[model samples]
Target: MQRLLRRARIPPVRTAPARTAPARTATVRTATVRTRSAAAGTAPLGLLYERHGEPAAVVQLKNLEVPKLGDCDVHVKMLAAPINPADINMIQGTYPLLSPLPAVGGNEGVGEVQEVGRRVAALKPGDWVIPADSGLGTWRTRGVFPEEMLLKVPSDIPVLCAATLSVNPCTAFRVLADFESLAPGDSVIQNAANSGVGQAVIQIARASGIKTINVVRDRPDLPKLVERLMGLGADHVVTEEMLRKPEMKYIFKSTPRPRLALNCVGGKSTTDMLRHLQPKGTMVTYGGMAKQPVMVPVVSHIPQSAFIFRDVRLRGFWMTQWRREHAQDREGVVAMMDALCQLIRGGQLTAPACTEVPLQDYRTALEASMKPFVSSKQILLL
Candidate 1:
């Protein structure tokens, strides 16, 4: 039942201006709005950064103006945005590659189209949408981006899930498609089963009639964790200790060995997944939350027809790739949104637990989001 709080009485938050082009190459698609006149008394308030640095080092909530929009651009009023690990990494300059200095944070969010420039079609004011990551700065109260970068979402969809849809759901879909040759009734195993991506994989696979063997690090709240994932349609749940136990052999006595193993936790968890793979099976690793390189026994890769060992293959996925592969991936995204909405409406897909944070409380929100035991996601309401 969580919802993103959209407009406030405050003025819009602006962005760093786009670079100018040569006169010969420039096309005057629209009149440039006067920076001072257009903004007049309207001051922008946002989580601003003056440098590429750690979240704690440079990020601050301050007043600023809305960025200029081009003829084909649209201005979006942010509804709610999620504080993802990647957002923290981007702000920290710890990501594999960092954004330009002084850039705003956040990549996943839901927004309402507030205004559109001339020649803009397909979208109109009041439409709920998600901007493509190429647009990047969603933490602010508002943003301006080319219309092509916006993906429309139905108004009835839950804002919490809409804010999270772009990355986690896409990662889950891609991993399910890229990894092992999965078939109905076949089994897949994954660690970090309570994670956003893991939860999506469970639901998607279940919808396809595929079974799952979910693994998680042991915790005092294991029972609640199991209940949550099971509610999302998980087949079985086990702790790392249970998975590594010698007596656990008979548990797979009648059930088929997993053909696909999805690993998000590396190190020992990665090794654990490889041990559960059937002959000629595949283990696809997409994340390393354990912060350690995967350690695999050499024997797991030795080719043997019966227990044919193919080293677990590793692949990296980013939603940007999905967008690149299909320029209209947004349409597919909307379709998936429709599917998730149906599940939610029918009372099948329960809403993920979400905590709403005001734009000014980002620091506390960021700290809480980084905690090891927060349920589901933390959302920033504009």
Candidate 2:
């Protein structure tokens, strides 16, 4: 097994100061650290991990030989990749699926094809693409991957949206389309409404003429967050405290009871969200951000007049599983991507707020990603 490099730190590269610099040259010199060379070569720099551990501790910047392309393969030049929670969890060895040791560290990103094998017909140099599934190790500056493992993405779409389109937005789309037979004017309620999936849901739902009741935890910036979500087309935004109040009943007078509920934060939040669902409605659980188990109160348990009486259905959704089940359905995946890109190009969907850091400053990006209450997504730029 490959072991992690045990070096304590790798310092940033610096160039020697120029002699007799003009006053105007000072500003240009200060920005040198942020620029990167786009030249291609046998050795390229990448973020790598030889073992599972804290991202800051285990991940290191190293020079790696560019992977050689094989028949039916393409060499991709990474444009931008996001640091996601799942990427962090994979680094911690806590995710359900783990890659072999000495792995590259990102799952989703957008890249341009730099070269294609002679046998490759569908793609060529300069075409934009994204990994067909997770574990393609997208953080590197470039990689050679099998043509089948990538899906073409429109270059016209914003780089951020294209980079992130395969995961969260797709998750939101699947959860809405797969589970329920929804119609215009129908309403859905969901907690963690300030999340990436939540924002996608709000915009997608709005475009389909569906309504959304967004639930979020209260914070010092609660008002601003609510306004932001509303600006994204949420029908209503309520805090967990507001959801528990009897006054919430007034909200239903205008909007019909939610036909579906999406849960990310489990524990009390799940139970409270269930309380607002229409009888015989379905609740889909996608994440457990609160690190609490989904518990059903004994007093309102199924034996009594609770879940069974209401004919409520509980289901779980994992994007990885969905990909596996539909791996061979290439047309389906392309259609979904097309819809999302159209939404983005049409201005109906917007990428989440983001902070970009050059690939060399990954340590700072990793630290920021782990901070609590961080609303901006971190993207590593080449």
Candidate 3:
């Protein structure tokens, strides 16, 4: 009887509620497996904008959270970016548009991609890139943004040079390329030859076999300045003061007559350039550093072109517009940069001296950078 009880004690195995839908309904399948989210890191390094106003309004270095990534995003570690005049103006809230509050302040930097989203196919970690726009907040040690806005930079190019490339070099390219009819034998004249854009234009024109007559403010190192420019392929180097010479026609006759002139400095500087331009020539103005309106003489009028009275037929060239039209020419841009790099490597291209500083030394660096005679372009290295 005890053995019979033991057998009966073993309960029958219970079956799952015969899941009328095969033990488990499609609606009641195992819970979906979740993939891990992207890892977050410490805050990035950068200059923050606590307020809006003047240069002293509030530019400070502070740690901030790494920006969150989007589906087509790229996270970059900024190597270096320059402090251009535009940057200063932007920070002072004097520029055409002000940056958002509590934003980072810097444009034109070179960086390495540290992370990329699944949808970002073109770039990968460790690849060097730059922003298409100079004002895209490049002062940070790291940032996250859509891949479409990034430009892959050549590894051979020096980081400092890469940092300054977006604005100046691109502007130089536009000035040279726009007047396609202007040829190698023709001469182009410009003021502010000491300016970054002016220097770039001289080099580019030299490379293209075009002649350039550069006009710069007289400096203590005038001789050296002239020598440097000549070495960069300047056909003739003159001072703006020379433009007012009563014997200007006699003096200009000995020099190449400029068929195309680039004027960035308005006021008296504009008149100076106009006086040297060959009749029917075109002058393109990209800036007005003189802080005065360009004044043209009434006698400059000629029947061939009414533009003369309008001051050498002035026209403005904006780099942003040029970039839009040539967006498809990324390869071309890369090629130009590569060619410049090759020249740099071959010793044919004289890279302007660079003043290196740490990323955190922006205030001092900025002060030195804005100084008129400060040697070399101030570069903030990460």
Q: Candidates' TM-scores?
A: 0.82, 0.87, 0.81
Which residue pairs collide in model 3, if any?
none
Q: Model 1 off-target regions past 4 Å?
A: 1-42, 300-312, 328-351
The best candidate in terms of TM-score: 2
lDDT of candidate 3 over 1-382, digit per residue (tens): 1121122231111111111213321111111111223343345667777566655447777775664677898888899888777778777766544455666777677899999999998899989888775457777777777787788877676777777877877677666665535555667888988777888878877766678888888878899888877877787888888767676566456566787788888998886777677776777777777779976665533532325343345566766545555567676556555555555556545545578888767888878776775536777887
Cα deviation at 352, candidate 3, in Å, is: 3.2
Arranged by lDDT, best first: 2, 1, 3
Candidates 1 and 3 compared by lDDT, better number: 1
Which candidate achieves the best lDDT against the true structure? 2
Cand. 1 Cα-lDDT: 0.69
Q: For residues 1-382, could you state the per-residue lDDT of candidate 2 as single tens digits?
A: 0000001111111112223423331110000011134454445667888788999999987766664678988988999999989899988988877666677888889999999999999898989999888888888887788888889998998999988888889888878776677778889999989888899999988888889999998888888888899999999999999999998899999899898899999999988888878878888888999999975443565533336677777777878767766787777677677777878988999887789999999999999999876767899996
Report residue 27 deviation for candidate 1 (angstroms). 25
Candidate with better TM-score, 1 vs 3: 1
lDDT of each: 0.69, 0.80, 0.68
RMSD (Å) per prediction: 9.5, 15.0, 22.1
Count: clashes, candidate 1: 3
- The residue pairs in collision within model 1 are 14-65, 14-66, 44-64
